[model samples]
Target: MLRFASLGSGSKGNATLIESGVNDKDTRILLDCGFSTKEVEGRLEKLGRTAESLTAIVITHEHSDHVSGAGRLSRKYNIPVWLTVGTSHACRDNDFYETHFINSHADFEIEALNLHPFPVPHDAREPCQFVFSDGASRLGVVTDLGYYTPHIISHLDKLDSLLLECNYDERMLLNGTYPHSLKKRVHGDKGHLDNKHASELLKKLDLNQLKNIVGMHVSEKNNTEEYASNALCEGLGCEQNAVSLASQAEGFSWREM
Candidate 1:
């Protein structure tokens, strides 16, 4: 069996726990460690797990909200960290227990889980998203990206599950109180994915085997769960309940494939 869960997701912090295999030999991997070590431990406990149970921590980039506790967690638990060369340079200060440099276009394995990292356009040091598989089931996680590109669409073709970003609503973003510069940055091509853009991208993907669709990294100041769900539902031609939202406080529970 293959299953995944999110500890939390937002601009403040983000972490995902993915497990592959069953019984005593399951392999667990944390996709990102954006929160403090103590906070992460608490969240892991919520899922009935501990930091020591993780086999590896895979970082998408060097952004503070994505890598803040990765080094500390790995060091404390003696877990290896996998990231790109650029991300390594950007996080030179963090002391990792073991570091494995991964290529953006390469496929790597962590026990029963297979990971494929693909580059994305984000304002960070070589940021990328991932597609994971446990031989039979595929799960794609695409977040913290600016605009959707053809390459991204191609990479996310068919999957058993998808966690896609629906960062903001254009109307709320334009009418909100954020400074002009910050607003521009948030809506820029190298910023985050707005609801409409995310919806359009979903419409172009192949979702024949899709069992779940999650809207993630929503902007608290500029987006609403209703809007995000409605947008993605429109694209998928499904009900609002079909697409779940990952929140800042209580991340969604585990879903299996």
Candidate 2:
């Protein structure tokens, strides 16, 4: 079976563990490493994983929130780290990882997981989210994008599980305590996704095969789990309980697909 779990996900940090294996041999790939090595290990332990379980570390971008611990963890564990060329250059200067530059638009297979990385619009060096499959089921991770594009929607079509971003509530961020400049940046084209945009994206997608849609990367200051879950469910015409929420503190438990 194929499954995934987030170590933690938010502005503070983010990391996802996607594992595929049968019987005994398993291939585990970490999607990002925003926390320190110790913290990542601790979270992994909670999820019944360890550093030795990883086959590789695949990065989404050079942003600290997504890559803070990637270099250190990969180097210490002697794990291959995959990223876009731009992201490698951006992180190479820091001297953290042994890098493998993968084409953002290409499809590749690593053991049981078929990985497809597509470009995303965000204020980072070559940011791209992923869609992973193991023949029977597909899981999409589409966070940190400012807005949904036709390419992204098309790529995620017929996914079994999705870790989609719902970063903020428009009204909450606009009228919250943050400064005007900060708010503008958060709402900019290269910034985070809001609830309305997320809802619209969900409405436009084909979710017939989607079993678990986790609302991820929610802002502590501007977004709440209830609000995001309700909005997504409303858009999908499903019950609110049908959608799950991943918070900054613990994220969510391992979900099977």
Candidate 3:
């Protein structure tokens, strides 16, 4: 079985825990480690896991909120970190357990899980998203991208589950307290996906095989759960409650595919 959960999500910090396989052969991959090492340990304890149990850590970019705890966790547990070369260099520190450079368009594996990385438009150096498979089910995670493209759609097609970003509401972002430059950065082409854009991307996907949808990277200041849920559900043609959201605090429980 392939199951995934988030330790936390949002600008403050983020970590995604995905597990596959059974018993002694299980493979646990962390997509991003954006918290303190101790904080990650505490959160993992909530899900009955430990940093020592992780198989690897895959970083999407060098953004602080997405890589704050990566080096420490990898060093403490002796797990490998996989990311593009640009992303690796952009990071301020290099004190990690081990670092593996990956191609944005390539596919790789770590025991039981296969990963496909696709380039994304973000302000960071060489940002990308991920899709994971255990040979039976596929989970696509797309966050921090400013917009979607046909190339992205092609990769996310036929996903069993997706964690898409719904960073802000259009009006709220324009009218919120963020400074002009900050607001522009968050709303620009290399910024984050707003509710409407994320919803539009969902509408273009093939959801015939979709079993789960989770809204990720929501802005606590410029967006609300109700607004995001309503927008995404409208595209999925499902009830608002059917789409679960990852919170900045508790994230969400694991869901199997």
Worst 10 residues of 2 by lDDT: 91-100
Off by over 4 Å in 3: none
Quote each prediction's TM-score: 0.98, 0.96, 0.99
In each prediction, how many residue pairs overlap at the backbone (N, C-alpha, C within less than 3 A)?
Answer: 0, 0, 0
Question: What order do candidates take by lDDT, descending?
Answer: 3, 1, 2
RMSD of each: 1.0, 1.3, 0.7
True-structure lDDT of candidate 2: 0.88
| Candidate 3 per-residue lDDT over residues 71-182, each given as its tens digit | 9889989999999999999987657889899999999998989999999999998999999999999999987998888999999999999999999999999999999999
Clashes in candidate 3: how many? 0
Return the clash pairs for model 2, or none. Answer: none
Q: Alpha-carbon error at 146 in model 1, in Å?
A: 0.7
The candidate scoring highest on TM-score is 3
Give residue 19's lDDT in candidate 2 (0 to 100).
Answer: 87
Write down the worst ten-residue block by lDDT for model 1.
86-95
| Candidate 2 Cα errors over 4 Å, as ranges | 92-97
**lDDT, candidate 1, 58-150, per-residue tens:** 999888878999988998899999998889899854579999989999999999999999999988888889999989989999879889889
